[model samples]
Target: MAKYLIKSDATIKAAKPKPAPYRLFDGDGLYLLIRPDGKKWWRLDYTIAGKRKTISIGVYPSTGLSLARDKAKGARALVAANTDPSDARKAAKVKQAEANEAERRVAEGIPLENSFEAVARAWYAKKSSSWVPSHGDKIIRRLERDLFPWLGARPIGEIKPPEILAAVRRIEARGAIETAHRALTNCGQVFRFAVAEGHIESDPTRDLRGALEPVKGGHMAAITEPAKVAELLRAIDAYRGSLIVRCALQLAPLVFVRPGELRKAEWAHIDLDAKEWRFTVTKTDTGHIVPLAPRAVEILREVQALTGRGRYVFPSARTSERPMSDNAILAAMRRMGIAKEEMTGHGFRAMARTILDEVLHFDAHLIEHQLAHAVKDPNGRAYNRTAHLEQRHLMMRLWAGYLETIKAGANVVPLHGRAAA
Candidate 1:
């Protein structure tokens, strides 16, 4: 039993290829295999559990005689411990791969794939496309600010309802009862997503019903009184801000669409000739048609002269590629000395809902339909976009005329259901 038989580098290099594969033994189950293709490979032959096995150590010159011997020594040690050298090598490779994956995830600020944060992020990425940008932003921000800090690192499957309640309690403690409820709802959506993806057994949020404080008076402040509404309209008409923002403010009450929808209005969706603004309502994922009143069309036409060729009807001042900031109209109102307690961008909806029903005396269903709400029919089916097109068009025209009369400081009396055409 000669040991280190092919010792020197010179002898190893001198060993030429053979007609068939042949080995040069170096004792202790280590050998150099020379093939007919003129390639040399280091191999280790060992027996584990009375079964013979061979594993590759390295190649010829690059591995060198010394390095191959070191690798062989390690393999032999594993074999002595009743482990198969080939199996040990495979297990080590797998362990190294797992370590690399973890390191990469950490570097990217991504939690473990099965963690609550990771699954929630995955859900957000999947669903946010259908949501308005502001709404999507709120969901991710809520998760990061309220829930991620506490439960993000925990495995999604191991999280219980109590842990979720504890995280939402922090949001409640800050007096954001509405936001706390919203955070809980968002978490439920994420958990249900996890359940569908097989990351968790069930949604834990379903277990914690009625656990938080009820939201007290979450309505946006609005001026529903006719006199105050007239003053607001006059102020909006005289807004000394950018023409684009002023138009948005003036149109807000007339059309009464959501602020996000107004700012993100695209030129492609507006048809002045048809006197309609068509867009997908992101909240309900439904197609919506806003039959532009004569006044609303006039406002759009005036702004169209400035932004006709762009993607957005009212683009951001800094860049035309995007819409105006969500805060643009609100900021303009604040600049005009309208406090948040007095009015907000969203307050227009409440204002219109009240005025259209109270003073104008329009059909409640038509008002709700015009508001793009989920108005159902007699059979419990939801009304389509153009359910009462003729009446709505007439209603919008009258509503615009009424606003003009009030803004002129005319003493206007309520139509009291006489205005519905």
Candidate 2:
């Protein structure tokens, strides 16, 4: 078919509107529609799927005769190819919109919606609330430090198993084998979340099982022997550091709470008259009652003279507004000639757990409850914080007395019914 029958721009310019809408046919289903209201439009009429359709090419003069014919030719090509021009136009519009959206996301420093970082952040936001604050902090820090720098910008669907393995391998290369494993697990979660959200087909990390080095399991170093325990108690007594940290060191074995719990202890949580310290356990988000032994109360009373007005019982040496530093106890122990393998801040818990059961012969359940562990009932239900408060109170007193005996260089034999005595 011969096209561009409208030879001159002047011919189109001189064509005026008639009393009613009429067409100036330009051949091959292209026409100039002259409206009675003095308006002219370029139109392309086509047939596809045995149905006739019309599409607007442009306005009359602004889209010149040449441009309108070009548009008409493109639409006719689609019809000949068995494709609908209208559908093609709509698809182009959607593609352009997606490009614009991607540009906007990049400009704002936001990840594309299907990018690994984007999905990982969404997953973190949804799940972090259920975790303890410190735990949640660790997870995000792991992603940012280990994974985000490497794999964050990639589309979650396009991330392969090797890319993920390579990212975590950097962490392993730094000797953080455990952290590398954790980073891989976090990536797997984000990938699974993307899959559930329809962004990816499968978790690539699934193919990476057994790819990294296994973490060696070990317990915190602790002084559980009675003689070493006595030596540690005497070393703490002679620690001429800040009075607050000294009291913390003194109370550690008596209460035997986690190092974090001990460092973050608050004055408001203590009831010295009742000989108990009550606070929420950060690890489990459950309430715990520490039956403060008489000796533990004595240490608190001494520290109270200095820090009773502050928020934390063991306030920072440099700033009372915050709790003591996490390293305060460790640093103090290091200064006292205690090796890391000999004892640690967390070792106090293991020390108490072992000695209380083996030497003191306290009931295992009561000791577990005192240790703020998840002690379950006979029916497999978890026991509440105050399950064995009375017995635990007696056990704490006996334990405190036993410590004093050992600290005084006495060969204290562990006797049953010592609590009654």
lDDT of each: 0.89, 0.89
How do the residues 167-279 of candidate 1 rate in per-residue lDDT, one tens digit apiece?
Answer: 99999999899999999999999999999998877888998889999886544788888889888998888888899999889889989999889999998999999999989
* Cα error, candidate 2, residue 29 (Å): 8.2
Residue 407 CA displacement from its true place in model 2, Å: 4.2
The number of the candidate with the highest TM-score is 2
Clashing pairs in 1: none
* Clashing residue pair totals per candidate (backbone < 3 A): 0, 0
Residue 370, candidate 1: alpha-carbon lDDT: 86
What TM-score does each of the candidates earn?
Answer: 0.72, 0.75
TM-score of 1: 0.72
